[model samples]
Target: MTVALMWEARASDGRGEELLAWARAQEFPREPLRRETLRAPGDRVLVITWWDAPYDAELPELPEPDGELLTRAVHRWRFESVGDG
Candidate 1:
């Protein structure tokens, strides 16, 4: 089975670059099979990591950034791969 974890956050004011740098600097206990970091308008950053584990298996995830770094709590989600589509 394959599991994908999604973590999204919105940075405060004009701190998008800072938030992106912070997210990229984070070190996981173990690296994921695949990892992607993305940013969008409104100073939002998103990270998705793919793993070779079951949907319910324990996995590494990005921790919430410090309160002053974000406008609100981070959002996360987990999904089991269905198909290439």
Candidate 2:
């Protein structure tokens, strides 16, 4: 099975671009099968990485950026593929 890791963060006030840039500059501990970055209306950034691992396997994740760049702490979620979708 494959697991997908999603990491999200909201930037403080007018720092959306800065937060996005910071996220773009980060490196995952292990290479993922697929990776994507997304931006939302409320200065939010989302990163999704797909890995070839069991659902309960431990995986490395992107560390939170400095507090000054964020409006709140980062959020994360993990999901495993159900079937050939």
Candidate 3:
């Protein structure tokens, strides 16, 4: 079975560029990892990422920022095998 791991994060205003840059620089060696940014409907900036494997497997540690403007952050994942509905 295949699974997709998703991470969602939000940062305060004026901090989107920095946060996005830092995220882009991450070195997670997992296969088929994709990152995307979106504006939160209510507040803060949102970032989402998808990885082409189960979330429980080994993954590169994300770089930690000295200071972050993230007021709210969340992580979730879904699993689906190839050719599965």
- Cα lDDT of model 3 by residue, 1-85, tens digit: 3444445556566676666666666655654555565555433334455555564655443434456556555444454546636
Root-mean-square deviation (CA) per prediction = 0.8, 1.0, 3.7
Residue-wise C-alpha lDDT for candidate 1, range 1-85, written one tens digit per residue? 8899999999999999999999999989998999999999999999999999989999989999876999999999999999986
Q: What is the lDDT of candidate 3?
A: 0.53
Give the range where candidate 1 is weakest over 10 consecutive residues by summed lDDT: 60-69
After best superposition, candidate 3 residue 30: deviation in angstroms? 4.4
Best by TM-score: 1
On the 0 to 100 scale, the lDDT of residue 70 in model 2 is 93
Model 3: number of clashes? 0
TM-score of each: 0.96, 0.94, 0.55
Model 1 TM-score (2 dp):
0.96
Model 3 Cα shift for residue 35 (angstroms):
5.4
Model 2 segments beyond 4 Å from truth?
A: none
Winning model by lDDT: 1
What ranking emerges by lDDT with the best candidate at the front?
1, 2, 3
- C-alpha lDDT score of every prediction, in listed order: 0.95, 0.93, 0.53
